[model samples]
Target chain A: MSGFDVGGRLKQLRMQRDLSQRELAKRAGVTNSTISLIEQNSVSPSVSSLKKILDALPVTISEFFAGEEVSREQVFYRASELTEIGDGVLSWRLIGARRPNRRMSILHERYPPGADTGEDMLEHDGEEGGVIISGTIELTVNGEVQLLTAGDAYYFDSRLPHRFRNVSDSECIIVSANNPPSFSDGGDAQHHA
Target chain B: MSGFDVGGRLKQLRMQRDLSQRELAKRAGVTNSTISLIEQNSVSPSVSSLKKILDALPVTISEFFAGEEVSREQVFYRASELTEIGDGVLSWRLIGARRPNRRMSILHERYPPGADTGEDMLEHDGEEGGVIISGTIELTVNGEVQLLTAGDAYYFDSRLPHRFRNVSDSECIIVSANNPPSFSDGGDAQHHA
Candidate 1:
């Protein structure tokens, strides 16, 4: 879904919690206009801003996304149905698009040779685990680097700074699942070059 | 994994947290013997007892199970490779068995007609979500009941009292994922008839 839709979901959650826009904005340390703008789809809230708003609601990011667009009934998404969430050399296929009430996001991710996850490391709440399905990838969690090949898996708290890159000459594929969902753009990974 | 295996995992977690057995018992409100017996595989803990012990550790059941047998490097489990954790009419196939350090438990669950989750409701920690892959099932959360058919999905906090049954005549299949992991035998679903 687009950022515009995220606004409506935020509004729904705010109302469900019986908090007015002004009250929520105050609790979230954001301005009432910011909340209003987000709800009206006039502006897209940044990931940090959205995190603050969700924290004030006492809801996880995954729950917030799960509460959006409850009308969908499609299940068992085929490979073609996976939503493409990444840009650059990283290709991320997110299972179940517009799935309501999602607690975890299952991703089929692919990284081509020489792919790097930019310079800025990723830090988020919740937990993440993945299994390398093919080829090899270099996973760095809080500066602890591990070169994981096919069949190698990892589980870690997402709050730790982490990055992934394809160190091998061949392509790498991984199936990963994470909770609380990530609010950043799928391709937040910057190219090392 | 069996109850004996759970004991080893519990011990590992306790050590990892650097908590003495006596201290853990005190925190869980159970006797030291209970903790000792559980850790030694001399006694199998009930679901409730296990919850208390896990809560004392501040770890979810999912995390506990995920911690067990961390040495394996197998990934991409085939249908036959799925671990069978269920008994009776409710069959559950767990993905990525023996894969180290998992954060989530994904289950391919099937329930034959007339199968019910017993008289006692199931309550645990974490969050759960599932999609009805085929047939129909009745899901009760708290006290609200919903009959979900193919393509329908549900997500809720696992602490809430909930139960499931195959209310339809045909068999039902669901692809479910839960966090903090469930510790009971997959088929703890008691049949009413």
Candidate 2:
């Protein structure tokens, strides 16, 4: 946490919302002078104080801490720039993992034939939605299942428990979105192909 | 707003935050029975009451209204699925336009050599970030200019006026993300190539 530009980031956050220091201070329950002081890097605010201010922006402490990580991350990603994770059966290419406070998880996911999301149903936070760019995928959500084809799409509550399977004899490509970004987390499972 | 499934959407919104009816009612400063009646479609909620309920989830009325449109939309998009706009100089492929309360704008952008983002600089709300997937392009942000090649990325506050130009001899491919999903919505311009 040393050398973290808390002031600069705070200013950026405030500005991102188009909020003035006075407005933000009011929202954070802090004084205008405190906001000015913090932005000027004059004082090292306590974690609690910082949390109070940050909560107004609604960013979590984890994301606040991860802000530095995003600064070191590249602004753009090409095909080779994607963070790739695969289980020999499926390939997940994650985009924009370095964006600070990423509110969305966008992935280029590929499932080879006969691949299944293991024996257990996959469950997680947030909602999951995707469009089938190619091939066919059998999607099961909360005991309801369907075989989706090219151009088919599904959006569901992730907490309902779901499993993705490529039961056909071809590869499937999906551009999937997960709000609040459930990636590299438990959502990527060791599948049974 | 006739035929709107306010109850179902309200229930989904409450469940999205993993909040129980009792808890959400408390947050909205309303009785649990009010929430129940609303969710059960027993009564039509006043706009003000609905606003109070929606505010607890921190979603805008516009987004809440847009929910029905999203439900009527497809989940997947092929190349043909993308909503495209360009001026013969650049091609922008917008993804996931149908998603409700879209928090991210993901674009597959192509800039032909000599293409530029117009004479006037571009400014918008939120941040803009993308990677140079292929070829070389010159970027200018707040008068700071640089040339980026494949794998090079930039992320900046979009409030700082910026411009893009492909001065190279070949075409350029980029994957750009705009937070809060600015698309088909004035970012496109009659760019001079």
DockQ of each: 0.03, 0.09
**Ten contiguous residues with the weakest lDDT in model 1 chain A:** A184-193
Could you tell me which 10 consecutive residues in candidate 1 chain B have the lowest summed lDDT? B184-193
Across A137-173, the per-residue lDDT of candidate 1 in tens digits comes to: 8888777778887645666666567788888899997
Candidate 2 ranges beyond 4 A from true positions: A1-93, A98-100, A108-193, B11-28, B32-37, B40-84, B94-106, B126-131, B141-146, B152-160, B177-181, B185-193
Best by lDDT: 2
Q: What does candidate 2's lDDT look like per residue over B161-190, in tens digits?
A: 678999999999766666545663343322
- The window of 10 residues in a row where model 2 chain A has the poorest summed lDDT is A65-74
Tens digit per residue, CA lDDT, model 1, B1-193: 2313767778877886788999999998888898898887776675456757877866544344432232324333444555776776788766554534444676667799988886688876556666565798888877778888765566666666778988779999766667645633344532211
Our tally of clashes for model 2 stands at: 5
State which candidate has the highest TM-score. 2
Pick by DockQ: which candidate is best?
2
